[model samples]
Target chain A: MRLNGNRSFSSFSFLALASLLALFLFFVTLLLSVFLYVGPRELASSLLSEEILFSIRLSLITATMATAACLLVAVPAAYALSRFNFRGKGLVDVLLYLPIGMPPVALGAALLIFFGTPMGGIFSARFVFEVPGIILAQFAVISALATKIMKSTFDGIDPEYESVARTLGCSRFQAFYKVALPLAKGGLITAVAISWIRALGEFGATVMLAGATRMKTETLPVAIFLNLETADVVKMSAAVLILAGVGLTALILIHKLGKRWPAV
Target chain B: MIRVENLSMRLGNFALTDVNLRVQRGEHSIILGPIGSGKTTLLKCIAGIYRPDSGRIEMDGEDVTELPPERRNIGYVPQDYRLFPHLTVSENISFGLRVRRSGNLEDRTRAMLDLVGLSDLSRQCIKCLSEGQKQLVALARALAIQPKVLLLDEPFTRLDSTAKVRLRRELRRIHEQTGVTIIHVTHDFEGSLNSRNRVAIMNDGRLVQDLSEIKKYLDEKLGYIPIDLRAGG
Candidate 1:
């Protein structure tokens, strides 16, 4: 076993690896124990209840809408950042990253203040503390992440693909849509899934802006928090199960969609 | 006919200075040079991909120096073949005509595939093609629109000896059939250039010679005489 190795890392590497794995299992086991302790009866009955069902439905719809809004803005923004030279390019990048760098509650408060202004008041009356507010808050919290993923995706493609398309008779916009977008299909799926999942579990901004109105604006994450306030552990456990089930199903669905395009 | 008058630009470490040449209609010309020799840069400028800071590119007596690439009906195939991965072979061939909203999409695509002898692989994805097949797909896509001029950068760079022989034969056949003017760039002169084709030699970003003396450059052993070697002590 010691063919010129001199025991350099043989024993220490094994011990260090075991130590790291133990630490990983510590967190995972801690989370799993809660599900087991909550028992199947509590998980099943609470999950099937009307209030939890409404929260789950509202959460899924808002997350889906937020991800769509994120993609609508981020796709072009990321493409421009990847493939063009323009004034204030660096400033635009900084603006995109501001929400990600700050806490979500700060962004929610800032949005609240801006929406309260005279000019923003018209739309604010309809947006603030409503279902629209939930979608807007989730969108704000997740768009930076989506933009970041998409920018990296566009950067990986050779800009020559677009150049070649243009010389092949495609206009600039046509080239982007026909070539770049299709080639980036896999990356776009990942970006959307990440946005959807992040929005699904968003807590701070959702609670601040959407106001957790029972049976109305209450998303799954807000339902969990409200359950905690009332010491309703069974309902909270069911909400966690719903979020986990939704996240896994979304990823699997997107993975299948990504297979349809199958970028080389 | 195609003409370039005083084409010059600076791209990274390379600078092409005051290059001028003319290619007559239906004539096939080859530009020979080593790597980083500004051959691709010159072609890109002519294709309208890179705007040369100073120059004029005229095709069929119309100035296309400032026209966007889409407006210029020139077919260009880069060395790597840049085929759209998501598109099938037939889709790739029809991409050009589809973009231009040209009539007879299916007819033109079938003709191009038949010309390249890829009629059987019409629905195959690009990833499934052999290197030689990919090259043909790139060529077919470019030709679908019936461009007045065609430019190929290193058309036969990375190919097996068998594939190289076949591609050369195919290219020669296509040129004869279409009568389209072509400007092919490559490093191989002995195998790629001939008396029927005009040749230009480039070094360090300058056109050293436009083969005003063709025989002088064709002999591989005699072509590479360093200026200092011929200089007297």
Candidate 2:
């Protein structure tokens, strides 16, 4: 009976391993399929086009800005969530989940509606259909993701280190920056890389708020959409490959850094 | 001098109830109790990490009930030692001094390293140290700040038998060398009890006995003398 049980377990393990390989192959094939539609020469020409170049620049700049803004707010917010218990903490947690749980299209529509409100109208000119709108949209979508990542990072760290620092003549801020922040280096890197990649790939919110204007507020994802609308599969494939390459590079870097500095 | 008067605190299901204790200057006092007896909580209250609901803590005869941990001038060494993983031994020892911007950084760090006999491991990473070595490094770090009182929670709990015996000796030497007031809490009666030290016994979040009262309490409760107490007696 025990030998039969062991044999069944072996079979189950093989099935699980086969499923993992199948999923891995599916993603690899899906990513590589873009190559079938566009030749290398055509891809190169499409990538070097003024519109594509503009979208690449715009995407990098806006994603960097959005990721920075997300981290600036997320780090402290995550620390508060991880460390302190305050009144309405449950409500605060639910509010943070709204962005992550809601569809990006709905969030974008909400922003569009808010921009039409009297109070939001004052700043609508600065954000709506503007370059800043792309940044704001990306930040709105990914800040919660950044916060969630950082909160888990801070959670893995013991609070006693900070307590010890506080008793060692460090003010609260000093303790956080000196001890807790250093320990959270790996998590912070993961948050930044993931948020930047997500912001780079953002489509629904950016298109809704910023409008897919050619060469004006065009990001990589937006450019891909516009290319596909005109049936320019070559240019769309080029954009897809670029996005995949950058995201892959970033993931590899994060993996390397994670090895070097494992989280506390 | 450190005094906790009428201290009471409730956290989750564990509560410290009306706990009162005092440790005079230049003395080492051990708060002995079993696990979950709220001994660490009481130490935390005195360290100002947790505010007691109804008590006032006094240091040097001044009330410090409202003071934050940073302002309390205490040294806290928790059970795990909590050495900063990214730091070296010297860096960990000098952390308090550097944060406070105290002068003579090198001199103070050197003194602390020498005091703990860890001068040779100054540049060693925290991960490389043994449990006993980490304990000494923690001791050095706490003493480097010249704190008004030192609070140690289960300092020897993680050590091997050999390291524990060695650490116990090192602790006594450190206490004598610095003359800093110390409140060391542990569950090991045999390892901690010393004739020269003041000992307090706690159960159910209350201080049930001190050195003078422990003999009678043990006689009535356990109906026998503990080996350590007999040795001390």
**Candidate 2, overall lDDT?**
0.91
Question: How much is A27 displaced in model 2, in angstroms?
Answer: 2.2
Docking category of candidate 2: high
Q: All candidates' lDDT scores?
A: 0.86, 0.91
Query: Chain A TM-score, candidate 2?
Result: 0.95
- For model 1, the superposed segments whose C-alpha errors exceed 4 Å read A1-31, A116-122, A253-264, B193-195, B208-233
The runs of at least 3 residues in candidate 2 whose Cα sits more than 4 Å from the true structure, single-residue gaps closed, are A1-9, B210-212, B220-223, B226-233
lDDT of 1 by residue, B2-61 (tens): 999999999876798888878899999888888888999999988899999898999999
Candidate 1 docking class: medium
Cα deviation in Å at residue B140, candidate 2?
Answer: 0.4
TM-scores of all predicted structures = 0.89, 0.95
